[model samples]
Target: MEVSTSKELQAFGETSIEKIIEELREECEIEKHLPGGGYLHMSDELPYLVIYRNEDEDIEKGMDRATVRLILSEASFLIIGNKDFEGYQRLMFCLSEAMSSKFKSFLIIEVFAGDPESRKFKIKGPAGKLSTTIKVLQEQLDDVDSGYRALQLGETEVQDTLQRQPEGKKPLLDLPQLKDSGCLLLGVEVPPVYRSKEGEDYPVFFRSFKDDFVVALHKTIFHFIRIQTSSGVKSYRALGQKHLQEKVKEIDRQLAEIETSYEFLWLVSPANIRHIKDTFFETNYEQVLNYHYRLLPFDPDVLKRRLYNLKLEDVDDPALSYIFREKREELDLQISMLSERGSDSFFYNSMMLFGKISNDLQREAETILKEVNEKEDQDFKSIMKAEDFKILANREFDYFREQDKNFSSKVHVREDVNILMVSRGELYLPSDYKLNANETHALIQHEIGTHVLTYYNGQQQPLKLLSIGLTDYDTLQEGLAVLSEYLVGGLTANRMRTLAGRVVAASARMHGADFQEIFRLLNKDYNFTPQRAFNITSRIMQGGGFTKDISYLKGLVQLKKHLEEGGELAPLLSGKFALEHMPIINELKERRVLTPVKLTPRYLKSEETRKKLGKIREGIPLSQLINA
Candidate 1:
């Protein structure tokens, strides 16, 4: 609609040049979604522009989708696309005149696809000022491929570059009239690296090449801005989609809505764990008990349809887009798990959702089991009840709440919950559960200090996804929470063995071990008591073999790997995130898209706990944490 605060242009054509030129007087970001599928976008008033002619026949073949993605990603430069030669040339003349009038100089780069087998980028532009961009783009090409592609630099006259169109039709702009407009144009012929054999586009390779194209494009734009334009922006990453669009927020809200739609674990869990275990013990762990579950709150099919319809492509920011897409995929598996509850199909879905127990996970779990003898459980006297634990947990929750009024985490003692757990930022306690003296402080740190703390910290962030979680955050979060138990002088040899027993049970179940078989493996092989083994096996076998229990130890294994490589624990406390997502988190952090964490565990404040954490950082084995 409005190009400037005052000037309005309903359509894009040659006649609007003077009016558009008037709007370019002051600095402004321009955006127009045009007729015939063309779009004009600018991060801010800029001297350089990336142009794509939608009329190109090769564009319809999906060869330029990567280039298209690079354009739409909101790179710092002014970007304009058009569907016809006449209109495209006219729009360029307007841009050149307006940009030259404002900044006294301008750079324009037109991108088009080359032959499928070209295996090279050809830059056709003026020789003098274009060399820097040509050189940078050429250098980046080498980074994309091993050594097969080349960058070909060629010279072209200004009028010739602007006038050229597909199919050798005719020149659209007058050569003599436009030569002195003071804007340099570069026609960049990008080879379709993603083009497949049947001339169809290979969508997979497009992602591989998208980053390479974006990197080169941004560097070229950065150089153009630094050397040519009056723009004060510095980093290329600082360019492109600085503001989060409503579409992104809407998608985020919808994603959060669907995520909150069903409490997956709570629904899939058996309502009568204590009752079933009594029956299981009576049968001598021989029968495959039918576990009852909570009624489904929403239609799985309806929620899945809603999930698929929320298009991620509508999101502009690259960092948010990637994270949102990943969350969406994880939600699909989680929702599918609910539908597959109490069936054989559920285990496969569990594997997809929770991941298989790898050999390394198994070895680490087995190693922990061996290091911490099961007899340790009998040695420690259980001293604290669920009521005492709830009081301390509520105090911990209140401690954070005092710092931030928005910290709304609560603690509850419920008869329904089987043991200590945190769901939806609230600590839940099983009324009958008892804790030893050390277990009291450790469980407090584990449930409230870490889990509740991260929830509130994530809530402080504008992106609700952080508070909810990133994909596969359970492993990282659980590992970090388990570590909190150790940091607070609470992690016990028996506690560590409990985590190990989970991994063994999950592994057994995944390898076709039935409920009774897995129960026997934990009771007979791991030497866990009949009650403890039944509890572990029943927990894992809930919802037709939920394997999330494995995350407790598997996460610790990965956390140790992360710490051994010298990663810190503070940034992780900012919100719930997977260990592998540090780079994106760092990027979003640098971009100021995320808020600084509001809360960290109080465990880190203790002199002894800090000492143990320091030892963990120095590569001490996780099992050694018990002795620490």
Candidate 2:
């Protein structure tokens, strides 16, 4: 067949076995795999040739593998010269198409390859012949080097045009017309020949194709489009002409639609914002910034008006009204306290910020409630069944009892320490022991580390709220708690799963599922028992919303990653330690007076404990203690 058009030329160029093998070797290198059976090494400028041997014609009935190897031994060569830039692009495009074809062939052959004994190809003799054929084919592609050189020249012109664009300018390809072309690009596939594995299956059968390459290509194309659009915007600005107003507006509208679809702002309501600011500042700040950017496309006036008139009562259903009211009252009091103080204390500032957040949350809550009530199926109503309460109470009681005997003795010197288990509209606590391992950790970190540490730390400082808590204390508190778990080596798969399960159950409830339905779903879908599932789902449901449930897994994952990445836990822990309104722990560390900090009592007893509790010193840095 005669190759005519650019596409046809590209297709023909990639069809050569030499070109395919070279490309495959290059791809293997990119993925850090051994190239060319670890026999051949590649360099940017050096040319490598692949020779192909005809498998059927070369094989005689009595020929051994050594004879086949000798035939391939005569077929190796190195081609000289380089392809220009434009030619490289054309070659890559064509190669991409050829790879797609190869991928389809591999897909068809994969099932057969899965059963090695069923393979039609002979392995011992054919391996030598195949290697020889690849080498011979490499010698035949010397003519394409000039084509690559020509392609390079063309790419230079495109790059020059892009260089003239301004900073922060939208790219031309970002325009709706060009962006819409993404759908058309989906037809490309990854090639199978590029996807060879060492031990699993034969590479000849399971290679990657063009379709597999499509996803990666699409991303690159989109990135290129963005660059082009940004350049175009800069170029237009240089000419003092505005052409992207309508386009920008369209992009903004699309973004807004996405935000609304995902209920993006719902995450930043007063409670969440305050929780983030107070507990998890760094993480929450990023979330807040993201939400801020999403809202950036909108007019400030529009956002302000949206924030001002928003009310929980307007949207919350009767079922959710009580919960909303309780939260609102709590927020209002907090806000009121902050307003009266008018101080620069961290705690006061946090309260004020949270107050503003409360308003935003109330509005979103109302909207969600209204939506839930107006929807027809109301799948959530069934989840509120009475049976769920019994299951929750039973599980909470069992878990609490188990945890209490294990953790309480070390942490709480006083027998009066409570391990309260609130679930399914009821609070259950052993009259003697009132907290579980999770709750105990929370109190030690939040109450002792933050509240007590701050109170003691503040006595030395002139400020009072520094002892109270920062607006973003939740991040710090949660981070510290999770970190404490790590220090104590108490983080477990079951704990992680339970935390994740709470998020799932909350999402279910948000979609109109009730406690009972969520409980059953957890049991049925996730294989949790009736009682355990009910306990988890009910704990989340009872609080109007179960946002805290997400904190455990999120906190632990973040903490573990931080520690693994070499972040010190001692500084964070010491920054918030104290002994019953005594001296600040950090100050004590600086003075070399504070002993090593002890791991939480619950953590010491848990199966996941890293070191023995008896060996850990009180007030010492976690890193030093661990190393020591």
Candidate 3:
């Protein structure tokens, strides 16, 4: 037997019937039972259905037979045996009633079989009996039930003619039925005319009804087709366009205007170094008490205004909502930190967000420092001046431009420039500062590889959130920066120690340890150089306890775990993003709302560095790599 002869039939696929059979197995019992004189047994299970085939079929002719038995578990036991010419009428009625109860919905069963031109069809409803004339009046009347009844007389006349007609000459009603069956249409398609109309289509309905004796088999399959057609009119409204991208961009633009990075960076050191040194030497007490901390010229009100005015609710997507909400909270916390700069409350709250240094990390720092002090002093002295660093910056930018012609960022050097700062599109460096080869490479990777790369990649996207930075972006970005240091073979022991010391000092500062107390603890206990001790203490003591420094080490530990778990690096390079925003970024990419990254870091683009990444496979601990 041919399974299908048309596109519609082919769509049902070879497994469609098998799948329906499988479902029947789950919902009921199906088997080949004894045909001649098997006793009917009552099942305790309600609505038990069993389908079987008779063994009485002729072995010589090789003909197969199919039969179905339905047991209404709750109602009376129903035994339907196969019938001859009735053609599954008894089975269809039982199947319709069973399905109606199963689905808990009213159902209308229609059956069609044989050839397209000379097929036989039947219609039956589980509950309400549809007027036979419904098909005829469906064309002329709007009220479908009224139409069905209006044409009932015509249906009777047609049925009489159909009965008198010869085999293969009966009229086929392949017309359109009521729009919404609300009641199921088993296998029949009510036609517009009494035959298939040109260019007119009907939904394929699949259902079966059979008794135990006869296999009422009508192979009416279902097909599904997806067509992408556009209405000729240009004014058609698009769907799923919630303007989420635009709202995110607006908020991001406002954040960029704030430039929280530079705003938070203390213009003046809070700790009075001279006073602390003088007081330390003059005081008889072990702890120095006279050092004064200063706050920078910053107004938290402006940031509060921008943050408060943002309508994050306007964002429709849940992922975008989460991203924006986090950004708002982060901004709020930052503004609060800046607002309370130089107070005990500042350090306490700062530690709340960025965790305090654990005792193990502090002890590990001491052990690593001891190992470093034992080695022959190989101190890195700066060979290049600020002018040299500027030249190097320009050269690096030039190299990036070579890789991506669109790559452009300003490299600036000024006398008043505080430690390196990248803002808007410019890289700022202190005029007197210098960097050695290793430090230069690490700095290049930290600032340019991770920071600059994400900045430019963000610009390429429609959303400014990428460039403005996501909530807690500093942790991930800094983590990637330090990892880049290790990958480039530049993360030194001293740098690692300084990171550890910052954590220790943050804890000390939170506990009300004065600048001199923190400095002395690092210098005497940890054996850090006076300069290193001063720098670490000053960082914690600055801005009334800036917690941002803790992210470098925190990010390193977190990112190490991320990479160990086989997280991809290319996605992080797409923008100035936090690890948590990865899902949203991936979603936008899949939707084609965000474009492919236009600028990747030079290190990532290189085949050599990509291979070097294997060396740091599971990632070495900071203590293990300190001296190395």
| Highest TM-score against the true fold, candidate | 1
Clashing pairs for model 1 are: 74-240
Could you give candidate 3's per-residue lDDT for residues 115-195 as a string of tens digits? 344322333221133333333222222222233343332221112121211234221111122222122332222222222
Task: Estimate every model's Cα lDDT from 0 to 1.
Answer: 0.72, 0.31, 0.51
Q: TM-scores of the models, in the given order?
A: 0.80, 0.27, 0.57
lDDT tens digits, residues 139-252, model 2?
A: 211222223342221111011132111223222122232223321111111111222333332322211211122222223222322332222211110111011123323332
lDDT of 1 by residue, 158-197 (tens): 2224443333534334555346666766666666767664
How many Å off is the CA of 129 in candidate 3? 23
Compute the lDDT of residue 474 as modeled in candidate 3: 79
Clashes of 2: 88
State the lDDT at 340 in candidate 1.
79
Order the candidate numbers by TM-score, best to worst.
1, 3, 2
